[model samples]
Target: MRAVRLSVVTAAATAAALAAVTGCTEKSDASGGDDRVVKVTATDSKCEVSKTKFPAGHIQIDVENKGSKVTEVYLLFPDDRIVTERENIGPGTKQKVTAEVKEGDYRIACKPGMKGKGIRQDVTATGSGKVAKRDPRLDAAVASYREYAQEQADETLPKAKVFAQAVKDGDIEAAKKAYADSRIGWERTEPVAESFGDIDPKVDLREDGLEEGQDLEKDWTGWHRLERSLWQDKKLTDRDSELADQLITDLTDWQKRVGKAEITPTSMANGAKELLDEVATGKVTGEEERYSHTDLVDFKANVEGAEKSYELLKPVASENDAALTKELDTQFAALNTLLDKYREDKTSYVFTSYDKVGKADRKELSDAVNALAEPLSKLAAAVVK
Candidate 1:
């Protein structure tokens, strides 16, 4: 009886020791011992681990969300496989997830919050049970943004031609009104305008002279020359006709220079859809804490596209399409105001945690973006029609 009691006590003590080491009751079968703990810290800059490579074994990943918002940690396998996902980890919270990793490469990504930014790190398994570190996904995200910028450039040019024709047909007022209506689709392209450089000069806005209260010299700048021309006196001469013809030729040349700045609503929708898809797939990783300077470019492109489109469609609205013209005019005015705000708050409209922004400021910024989309969408649909 004494020998049996001693045996039971020894077994119980061993089990307790194992639980203390593993942080769980289950014993690891991979290494025949529970000894490895992979610690990952998710902070402002990255998802970093003390070691980058790990050996094949039963491993415990202890993730610490040190950022301002909730974060999720995902372990990804080579075949686009997600070995495991842990979610809803609040700021400063720590959670431990265990996985049986074989001899292979794996990725670790942490998404801070819904619609928030994400970061990633790579880990390699070695023979001696060490982890290798790599963060290639960061570069991958930047490459993706550049590709998107090129795609936007490809879609803007043809649309500019239709816009110039509207101006040449002695329909400056109609053009002005239509330009206002096409803001949404144009705004998306605005973020990439600088990439195209001096393309707006191809659209000629100088054929008409300034009218009362509308000074082209005061208001006109590059692509915005069209808007400035709108308030000019409605008179045409032989010289003006020649100028208009020249303007059309210039616009065609500009379109060729800029490529296509006009991306259809369908295409814009598709791009947005792709962005959302990447976000959902845990594939969207980049530094977006700052307002994507690209957003400003998109804003400008949209303005340019709208200005050109308006030049083309203004006549239709003024003659046979009065109702459509009036609706477009109203939408464009609101959009112009929105663009003004964007220009003013270009650097301020960034994506950071609520904690990083003052309460009133955050609300105001969020409201501005939210307000613009619906009105912009309405305008885009009208212009496309």
Candidate 2:
């Protein structure tokens, strides 16, 4: 587990819950008896989604973790592609999320302890699968985000290859330098990458993200695995070289598939919040770039991606909730200003290693992240309203 240096809002509180599609959902009872709202009761072994069938548009999931561990909920396509998800739901916490789903077979999966494939319940959406008519600006926002995701994928492959080549050549110093650079594009468009269901685990999964009983030599083969070789292990292996090739292969698949991802204004809004959650859980905690201490680099990219989403949705969100937009603007500026102070080179993205950062400073960063996150949680609702 990553070290938690300060109190920060969990992903459930800061990012999860509200997601996808058009229209607001009517409130429902928390028990597994709600008719309109899809009430989900998650225990260690069971994931109970109240109604198996519902109307096609405006799908809402009201999740309560009656389990002993932190859990996650997902709306998955029949092929297991993630439509949208809410992660890090602590025991006894309740989350309400809404997503746009077309008429299709789907699964509501809940992962207790936030690990493994999760207990899944079959679900389907009935009736005309058409989504509610979205505003023109929201449509434009989806289009723009799709383009941005593609661009990030298009750029990531080459940079990743650079890191891969350095590893293949067994050049430790070069590999170290290229590692953080390659990850920037991935961090920027993480949500789009994650929508694929399979790619992120293959290309970016950290060692700790592995399921229980998974062998490191066999199961752990991604950026973090390679990262250990360059930094902590202080050595390279023939397997590391093979992993470098596999990383490129996985990324190539991601680049090819990005255009097919489902992008909605609400998804973008939810994704922006997810980015901030990454900062709080991984980057701010110094667990993401643990050996490299390049958390700040990833931190910056996450914020930039979140800001881009917010900016794209601002036109519509401001109209729906001007106060939220204004508060978000102030918070974003505050966070950015705080981050800038850590940068030794304002001209470049590099910053001081996180290990050098004091505990109080970390607390300050965590607070800034939480301050922005509270408003970010309302982003999906604002855009859809």
Candidate 3:
């Protein structure tokens, strides 16, 4: 697999200059003097040209953001001089930038959102000019995505180990509290739950917590019982030794799962889509409001999922079916852009008054997320086909 690089959108001044020079064509009365126009569209970290050929002299770049995020487009010269930069073209929107060129070989680099991969194309300055195929944004996005995942994984493991040790050391009360707190990390990683499926059933305490002949609550609340046991000094008796051993076994299994698992792009995309759907349906309930941490955790999970999806899909973009690839590219870009706003809004909550963020704020967030559904659905449909 090709190594992915972290994507940080470089300033216009930092990009390469156009190198290839071409002869000017005689102006014809029928068409406007040899001015060439190129339309560059970015979707799912890939760039495509509506037309391959145009006249060279003054060039106009029309950028269409068909993806789910904002994107940056750059026209570069051979000398690494940036001809022009068009930044923050929002989802489903379009923007134009013009540059005068003597013509030669120039590169067009488009990055979908600040953190996304970049798409690059090499164009030749000919009689007019022709758009060539190149994709650097995809590489950038994938690289950034992998980098983000690795960081999260690194942070999560040591914390999990600390909590696990607390449990083994008979610091039951501390272990219970840590377990509850740890849910924030685990829930963000629900898609990877299978990796931790070996959680020791003995530690679950679900069966022992039940009252004689009583029915279990629909919600998974066994953690609460474990909490009580820790504080109440209700140590397992000799007869319960078998269950304790089983619990230890389960925890060990969970550790292995966490160590070996790799998160896939498809899973991240699908999971985010589902969570967003729930939010749209208002199924998230008051728990989301009361437990602000839940919202924060969910937001992080969604971001991670979006990042991973871009990473996985970007590398395969060129090989995908044309229409499908184009559609996915567009959606991925839009989603990445939208996530930036979502992250900002979420961060502001730390200082902003939550009570003031009422219905309008929630609606705005929902609308931003809903904007992602169409493109994502199209991408999903294409994958199945």
Q: Root-mean-square deviation of each candidate, in angstroms?
A: 23.3, 5.8, 18.5
lDDT of 1 by residue, 1-385 (tens): 0011110111111100010011111322234333456688986567888777766645677878899987767665543233444555778877766554556687777776522324777887555553223134322432444445454434434444444556667676555444432222334433233223333322312213222354444423323345434444444334444444454554444335333332222223222322222222221121111211122333334444443434343443246446655665665565456445544354432223323445464344334443433233232223222
Most accurate candidate by TM-score: 2
- Residue pairs whose backbone atoms clash in candidate 2: 21-100
**10 residues in a row with least lDDT, candidate 1:** 12-21
Candidate with more favorable, higher lDDT: 2 or 3: 2
Off by over 4 Å in 1: 1-139, 181-186, 198-221, 232-385
Q: What TM-score, to 2 decimals, does candidate 3 have? A: 0.39
> Model 2, residue 165: displacement in angstroms?
1.6
Model 3: lDDT to the true structure: 0.45
- Per-residue lDDT, model 3, residue 240, is 29
**Which residue ranges in model 2 land beyond 4 Å of their true spot?**
1-34, 128-130
| Winning model by lDDT | 2
> Which is the winner by TM-score between candidate 2 and candidate 3?
2
lDDT of each: 0.42, 0.76, 0.45
- Candidate order by TM-score, decreasing, is 2, 3, 1
Question: How does candidate 2 fare on TM-score?
Answer: 0.89
